[model samples]
Target: MTARVPHPPIEPPGTRVRFPDPVLAPSHGVLAMGCDFTPGTLLRAYRSGIFPWPHGDEEDEGGSPLVLWFSPEPRCIFPLEQEPHWSRSLRRTLRIHPYEVTVDQDFAGVMHMCGETRKDATWIIPELERGYRELHRLGWAHSVEVWDTSTGERELVGGIYGVAVGGAFAGESMFHTRTDTSKIAFATLVTKLRAAGYVLFDVQVENPHLASLGCVEIPRREYLGRLDDALEVTPGPLL
Candidate 1:
């Protein structure tokens, strides 16, 4: 059975809270009030469309108090009902490459690779990695992987990972190694999500690639309204 998540009381606008440690709570939803950034605390935040991204030293034993909770305004969402716009060049590349797509396979590897390849400082620190891995074990988080079969070796070429609640998929991060690989993975995932009867694919933020894929921004108020509808329906596991 899935764990029960409780909706916490809303925090006042413009109020900042410093979260330094993770909170381990059985409730799989947001804590009403806390300054902890523990595994359970992050888990609860994601379930409520809030994510803790802290910036600080990688090896600092004391850890960092510089943190921010993000719930993006004008959230990006893909229109899965519309036909996915695969460019002719992309289609040609697909024909030549013929990559295979897998879901929920090598999620930890994907997360690790994402962290390892970080050129800049990363908020997905060691603790965050362990936390998400635990969430993956609990089936609250998942990854979509793209594979190159010709090499007979698989690397996490491109994919997206995020939390699922009811019929909503809150996209966290997506990375790609090959051209259009991430786009392919995203398009395919959107197709699968549509088949599963999901109503929201919260891309969280927008960029050129996501915009090209038909992701649009809506006001935060409108997004929460949509979230309400999305949480009412049941959808299948992302895997």
Candidate 2:
């Protein structure tokens, strides 16, 4: 892969600006940006197609200030018009699934589980958690939850969360305790997004898992163009 040089910060008039990929070095396939990830600052970053990902302590401060900014070369996205591959096994699981799906329920709990690390320590510190929770409260961020009656009402099996800007839904993280649970939640969310006229589902960076679900990459310049169009359309509720 060719190394990209990070570009100097472009202080544009609006609260949004794209961080040049060439100047921002990626670590473990991610990048870092933003001085303070407070709710206000983080919101501004997402609006501009920038997001914070937790990084190692060796490269960043111990907690709140440690996340990195990333702009992947081939941004993974699911187009609204295309049908993502839903395998026979996955379809069977969805049909026989005992889990019920909900939106924006237990948003904080989902975040807590996502931050937990059985092996390495977590980077979603107190400040980051609080900030995202605030975004949820303000209706700018949301969570898709999967629950099972056998596991009890409070037990959430799978879900995904992210901030929604205009027609774009920037997916942050997802977790699942049962097979195909997260996939079901994601497929349902996509169905809702498409029905509501959303044009873009920004997965940020691409991975093999996302590729299997039909996500493809576009150049940063082209991504910015779609983002501009997406931001002009109104968003639909996740529920």
Candidate 3:
């Protein structure tokens, strides 16, 4: 038997990478599986309108769980032209201005908190965590941290984290330890993205919480078209 040869690493920050057409993906939305999480690979995947959504503990060659690349039909995204829906209570929380919002301050802390605070999911495995951490170090991943400043000491109460490419941002997960803190963090992130001229805000999938914040689902084809346009833009750095 011939020995298996490793593939070359993906290159460049904004290079386009081809992926299986999402239209041909199965009902479960997995476009591919079992790839390493190098920064170039993640950037290539995102640039191709795909993202990893690994589940289970089955280790791959990198001691990480087998990764699943997904490009779901009816992809959920936040429209860059409008503000997120704000509830009366959330408006009140914003008016009070009780928390300090910072960007890229504590990405790993936010990620770990998000994993720990997920309602009924165990998707943020250790291997994925390391991958995103590396992305953060390389300026492709970012976190919006919400801090409780009422007690004179800054305490992290909530945050949101995600990957960025060109004018697009893909929000991975968010968590809150205090009331409306995560919402505050998300709103802060959106504000920053908009100010920086981001054209797309891909939230991956919609949940009740995301829908409440005004995310909308569009056909994968439309999403791909928009993603293509987004990648052509050169927005200011999100961090």
Candidate 4:
């Protein structure tokens, strides 16, 4: 028998210098697993068509939950001209909702609200919060806030937060404490982003909640192509 040659061990998925391409990532859109949620890392991930989401401990081999990076196959996005579906009741609520909409007022506050867990279950773990907050300080993260003023006091009731690069706004999370509150906040966000000449609004993945709001999915290859176009648009301040 000839002398055997040794092969190199594979590095953990996504632990390499760059993210895995769509063809290399898993079907569930998980490009790679295991990474620290540093602000710089997060920025690089987003620009590379990936974002970090916390995995349950079950995904781990008995230690702390792991952070997994994803680039979903059918990536979700909001068309530049897409208008959210407005139910009759939502339209009425919009007319009577005594709330003020603001941008980047309290980005950390928005992230905290989104991180709030019900029955102690959530993916926005502590580390993720700190990471995004740092990104906010760097002007890469932003929030759209909704404040309730019907009671003569400004109470934060709804908001959405995301990272924006060039003309692509990658929505990370959103939260609401009142009916239609977050919905209206999202609408206002759309208006502002449109006026700002945003060419893409990436939502990461599609769900019923997002589909109702006009989020649609396209092949990852197509999304990457669009991402390239969006990133070529003149950079502008999103906050």
Candidate 5:
């Protein structure tokens, strides 16, 4: 049996549209459900401190999988100051590899690789990819890539991609085909954001992998407060 997500974002009465209010998002984190994942809706959701992720199965009574939106009560983020602590092995890997890191060279490649390289099931569906691709074209989304060209063909070993609004970077997903490649890409992104005066690197949720990268979680209210501050600066020269 599929365990329904608790306190899923409530739909408003008599309205076909859904807007997730950060101030009213439930403690369970989901803020809205069943909206189309278009560029406009996604951008609006991101600005409102909510993000969309759909259910893995098609169980909706209406025959469409719910496009569940979320704003976790304890939002995960990596403040620019608490930089990722690189382990000795990771440092060595970085030092030895001639990784060429670049920005926005191939956002779609990064996104596709991120989806294809996942070890388990992923929610980066085709709809999400298409929406993000459009966002990239509009300049609100960007990617950092770690390239390896020693094999005579241009190959992307690792990368990370996300949406940027003002001083906030909503990290979407990352993947690495080579050791420490994703780490290198992620570290580069954080450094660039810091230099560009960004304050928030929204990671969405915490896990052991991110914990190693110095990410932490703060309450939803606190995240919203900080989100306001992050919105003050412009995210530019996205390296």
Candidate 6:
């Protein structure tokens, strides 16, 4: 049976918050700060090519940690139609790896593991976590889970989660408890996205690990232009 997600009513008030123009943001891409994580607000920000990435313990007027929004320059992305380069070992693992892959089966569980596995320097703080959870419930966010079933009990060994808007996907975070499992989850995700007709796979930033998987960087202007095109395309169903 295909799993069905329950829908719940979300209030519309907080979504009305306005954000600054990302193009006008400073070189560091700190466009604006201070907004609640309402689904509407998040959707609007993403639609405008902006995303919240809160830092430190800075507080807003309401005494809560201020939300910092960014639209980075030299954005990192994975071309959906192109396959990443994989090592010979990784290819072999893909052929013989004994793990199960599932989608949206346990979004929260994936999230909890992502944070728990990276307790030091993790950015999936409490508020942001709740925000993504709400987005998941509303069908805007999704997760890809990798499980180890060898013990006859399914253990979540790796996973990735992100928000999808139209034909664009913003990969937020991923984690792995076993070697190469995260890479396995990532490869599976790219295949699924390409099959689903997704155009843009936004990694947000460049890292050595991602570069190893063929993620590349482009100027922010180019990213925004591509984002516009991606948003205009009728999004294929991805669940």
lDDT of each: 0.64, 0.69, 0.82, 0.75, 0.79, 0.82
5 or 6, greater by TM-score:
6
Task: Answer with 2 or 5, whichever has the higher lDDT.
Answer: 5
Q: Candidate 5 vs candidate 6: which has greater lDDT?
A: 6
Q: Per-residue lDDT tens digits of candidate 4, residues 1-239?
A: 11111111111223335666755786687776664776656767877788887854445654656877888888999888656566787778878777898888888788888767233337778777887776776667778889988899888899898987667889988889988778887878787788878888999989898888878888988888888888787544543
Model 2 scores what on Cα lDDT?
Answer: 0.69
**Leading candidate by TM-score:** 6
Query: Between prediction 3 and prediction 4, which has the larger lDDT?
Result: 3
Per residue, candidate 5 scores C-alpha lDDT tens digits across 41-141 of 77667777888886665435687765788888889999786655777876777677787888888899999999899855367777778888877776777
Writing each residue's lDDT as its tens digit, candidate 2 over 86-133 gives: 778877887788888887777787777666622343667676788787
Of 3 and 4, which scores higher on TM-score?
Answer: 3
Off by over 4 Å in 2: 1-35, 56-64, 117-121
Clashes of 1: 5
C-alpha lDDT (0 to 100) for residue 5 of candidate 2? 14
lDDT ranking from best candidate downward? 6, 3, 5, 4, 2, 1
Candidates 2 and 3, the one with greater lDDT: 3
lDDT over C-alpha atoms for residue 119 of model 6: 62
Better of 4 and 5 by lDDT: 5
Relative to the true structure, candidate 2 reaches a TM of: 0.81
List candidate 4 segments past 4 Å from native: 1-17, 56-64, 82-85, 117-121
Between candidates 1 and 3, name the one with more favorable TM-score.
Answer: 3
**Deviation in Å, model 5, residue 180 alpha carbon:** 1.2
Please, what is the TM-score per model?
0.76, 0.81, 0.87, 0.85, 0.86, 0.91
Candidate 3 per-residue lDDT over residues 1-239, each given as its tens digit? 11121112223354344668777886567998765677777888888788988776666777757778998888999888886677888788888877788888888899999988886447787878888887777677888889988899888899999988878999999999998899999888898999989999999888899999889999988998999999887777654
Off by over 4 Å in 5: 1-17, 57-59, 82-84
